[model samples]
Target: MLTIIYEDEQYVAINKPNGLLVHRTRIAEEKKEFALQLLRDQLGYRVYPVHRLDRGTSGVLLFAKNSAAATPMVQAFEERQVTKTYYAIVRGYTAESETIDNPIRPDKDHQHKEAQDAVTHYTRLATIELPIAVGRYSTARYSLVKIVPETGRMHQIRKHFAHIRHYIIGDKRHGDWRHNKMFLEELDSKALLLHAYEMQFTHPFTGELTHIAAELPENMRRLCLSFDWVNAVTKHEKLTDSPV
Candidate 1:
């Protein structure tokens, strides 16, 4: 069942699991289940998706109860008025803080489309060096990062991180195969490590500020526990500090 993290008269949010498509699309036509269908069935009502999350990314996803309610919410996202926070476990130890400003294609298949400007700010929260070896490195190094995107673009976080060569662990599309293989074979982790984490926006109808957070998914939490970064994860989950 989908976990409902926030709900009100006109809006609802779910902690979307990794690999769940936001809705039906031709690219994934063979997939029988989708978050939209499942959420609608669970609620027994129509819901409109205001934005989308990548099929491989898991975390806070918002929807409006009615079309009228969806309009403003959608506009908020388009206008970049909403704040989104994401957490990722990346392959190498990143800088204490960094910002990535680059252009990326809208999607992998749309090479003809013009690349859009994308900016991502991240702060390294914790680092770990596993004794296990992957590739030529004697020890595997990784970092937990808090990411905030200044613009919403397709695969922005994944692509931005890849642009800087700190590929997010478990990102099959743009990650290092050696690290991904290590994560799957050695750690038994298959889900993408990038998580939406939290979102804050103004209530479209009520004119109030709304902040919603989703707890880390089991796979991510387990990995954090193994890395001994659970305390850092817990501290950030509270949304205490402003987005970097």
Candidate 2:
């Protein structure tokens, strides 16, 4: 059963597991199972997705039970009123905090020179060094960061981190293959180490402030423990103060 994180008459949210598609798409037609279908079957009623999480990224996924709720939540996401926090394990130690403001082209129009503005704020929760060496360095290093995306462009987090030279571990696309190989060979990890940890927004029906969060999946938690970035990384959140 999918782990339900938050539920009310207006909407329900779940801690979506990795490798699960929010819904079937033309590109991944072979996928027979989907979050929308599965949740509807499990709940015995239709669910409307107000927002989506990438198939490879595991964490909170919200759905509106009725049309009235879906409209406002969709607008909230579009206008960037909702605050989002993500935890990522990236190569190299990052600064205590940083903001990435870069323009990115949509995948279909990547060849075009023009791009949409994308911004993300991130804070380093902890850093660790491993004795294993992969490249020119004698050691390997990684950082656990909590990120707040100011704009939700496609692949913004993955591409932004890649542009800054600190690629997220196990991200096959928009990441270093060398780091991906190292994580797979040494850690037995191939899943992307990016989690959509938390979201905050004003409730659509009740107008009350709402916040929801999901624990990092087991693999991600295990990786964090390997680096001893425990409680801090799990509790690290800096998303709300700086919205849009």
Candidate 3:
């Protein structure tokens, strides 16, 4: 059964596992299981997705129980009223906290015409230098960062981090192949190290503020443990002054 973290008369939140699709997709036609199908069958009722997470990502995923709850909740996401926190394992240790305010556009011939503003805040949580031989030296370094994207865009965090030369580990589509291959061949893991850990927003049904979180998956925890960084990282959050 799917892990239902929070539920109400109007909504349900799930700790979606990595590799599950939110709904049926032609892109993933080969896969028979999906989040929508599984959850709906579990509840024997309809559920609406309020937001999306990449297929490779695992964490808190929200769903509205009925159509009534879906509209306003999705609108809230579109308007940037939600605060999301993500934890990602990336290549290399970042020296300090940084905010990336670069704008991105669609990957089309007219990419310039469809540009959108993108902003992301990132804080380094922990760093580890593993003595694993890959390419250059007898050691490789990795960093964990807590990321907050102010603007929602397709692959914003992944693209932005890659643009700055700090690729998220295991991001095969936009990562350093050498490092990714090293992880797969040496570490026996192939999933991207990104998790949508937490989210905060107003309850569309109750009008009260709400916060939801997902525990770090076992694989991610294991990765952290390998580096002895499981306890070194600290999590911090603040509410925006704007009221619900």
Candidate 4:
């Protein structure tokens, strides 16, 4: 069953699991279980997706009960009025904090669409070193990062991290194949190491402020437990002094 994080007369939120599609798409034809369908069935009513989460990403997902509410919720995201906080495990030691301002093509085909400006701010929460050789290094180094995107673009987080050479763990499409293989072989991990943990926005209907959060999945928690940063980060309630 999908975990409902938030719900009201206008909207409902679910903690989506990795590899689950938000809706039907041409690229993933084999997916018979979608969040939309599962939600509709579980609630015995209709649900409209206000935003999308990557198939490999797991965490808080928002949905509107009707189209009337979906419009404003989607607009809130497009207008950059909403704040989204994501947590990721990535290869290499990322800086303490930095903003990635890069333009990304809207689609693979240049003729179809022009590039859009995309900006993402990320802060390194902690670092870990494993006694595993990868490439030229004798020990593998990784960082736990907290990311905030200033603009919404397709695959922005995955692509922006890739652009900076700190590919997120398990992100095969925009990540290093060697690092991905190592994670799978060593940790038995299969899903991308990205999670949408927190979101803050103004209620489109009630005009009140709303903040929702989801805890890291067990796999991610276990991975971060080695560094002992997850407890501190979670207990602190926020990443203070972050550049993002």
Candidate 5:
């Protein structure tokens, strides 16, 4: 069963697990289970997705209990009124805090590829250096980062991080293969490390400010614990405060 993080008469949210699609798509037709289907079945009613999270991302995914509530919620996201926070484990130590202002293709398809303005702000919350070596390096270094995107283009965070060469760990498409192999083979960590940790927006039904936060998935939490980043994992204030 999906973990419901928030619920109301007009909206409901779930801590969507990694590898679950929000809805059906032609690109992944072979996949059967979806968050939309599972949640609708669980509630025995229809739900409308206000926004989408990547299939590999896990965290607070909100759905409107009815279509009336979905319109304003979707509009809020389109107008950049919603504040979304994410956490990621990346390949190297990121800057104390930085803004990535770059352009990215809207989607992976090459047919209509056009670069669009995308901006992402990130702060490094924690860092760790391990003696384990994957390639030529004698040690491995990583950082836990808090990410906030000013614009929501597809794969903006991943691509922007890749642009600066601090590849997000476990990102198969745009990450360091050596580190990915090391994590999979040595650490047995295979899921993408990016997670949608929290979302804040005005409630469409009640006109009240709403904040929803999801706990880290077990895999990412365990990895953070192993790296001695317990404070970073447990404290949201640290994620938003002065960078480490």
Candidate 6:
């Protein structure tokens, strides 16, 4: 069942799980069922996706109940008015707080024409000292972070974090293979640690501000529980210091 996080006359938002697609995509043809389809089935009505979450991303996903609402919500995203906050377990001890303002370009021959401007703000919530063997006679440590992307781009969080040298754990495509393999073999975790925990935006119909939040999944919760800085960074009710 979908965990309804927020719902109103014009839109309904839910906490989407990891491994679910927001909608059909040409790249993932094997996905016979999608979040949009499932949501429509569960609600017994047609719905429109206001924004997209990566297949591996788990957290607040907003869906407009009708076309008129979807258009404005999409415009809000395009204008970077929507606020999003995410938590992630990365591969190193990050600084207390930092902001990454870099522009990303599509790789050669890939989809999209130009390099887009991407900005992300991140704060180190806590650092864990889990000792794991890396290559020959080497032990490695990693950190946990709360990330907020100011501008949404394709894989902005993942790509930006990776570019900063602290790739998120379990991000295979742009992550350190050694750390990925270590987590899988030792910790038995295969899913990416990134979670979209909180979101704030204007209501399409009422124009009244709205806020939605989702708790971290069991795996992430448990992982954070095993650390000390967890209480310092992870226990807060909100991810962002500023009001949405």
Best by TM-score: 1
| The candidate that achieves the highest lDDT relative to the unseen native structure | 1
Residue by residue across 46-116, what tens digits does model 4's lDDT show?
99998889999998899999999999999999899999999999999999999999998765645588789
Give the root-mean-square deviation of each candidate in angstroms: 3.9, 5.1, 5.9, 4.2, 3.8, 4.3
> Looking at candidate 2, what is the lDDT of residue 221?
81
- Expressed as tens digits, the lDDT of each residue in 1-244 for candidate 1 is 9999999999999999999999999889999999999999999999999999999999999999999999999999999999999999998889999989998886657877998888899999999999989988899999999999999998899989999999999999988889999999999998899999999998988899999999888788778877778667756454333221
Tens-digit per-residue lDDT, 1-244, candidate 5: 9999899998999999988999999899999999999999999999999999989889989999888989999999999999999999998888999999998876556648778889999999999998998699999999999999999988889899999999998888888899999889988899989999999998876889999998888788878877878777658533323322
What C-alpha lDDT, on a 0 to 100 scale, does residue 119 get in candidate 2?
100
Ranking by TM-score: 1, 5, 4, 2, 6, 3
Lowest summed lDDT over 10 consecutive residues: which window, candidate 6?
Answer: 235-244
lDDT of 2 by residue, 75-190 (tens): 99999999999999999999899999999887763666678999999999888888987888888989999999999988899999999999998888889998889899999899
- lDDT of candidate 6 over 62-98, digit per residue (tens): 9999999899999999998899999899987898999
TM-score of every candidate: 0.95, 0.93, 0.91, 0.93, 0.94, 0.91
Candidate 2 clashes: the total is 0
Selected candidate, larger lDDT, 1 vs 3? 1
Model 5: worst 10 consecutive residues (lDDT sum): 235-244
Model 4 is weakest, by summed lDDT over 10 consecutive residues, at: 235-244
Residue 36 of candidate 6: its Cα lDDT?
95
- Candidate 3 per-residue lDDT, tens place, 22-135, comes to 987766788899899999999999899989998888999999998989999899999999999998988887757999989888766456686789999999988988789767
218, model 5: CA deviation in Å?
A: 0.2
* lDDT of all predictions: 0.91, 0.89, 0.85, 0.88, 0.89, 0.83
lDDT-sorted candidate list, best first: 1, 5, 2, 4, 3, 6
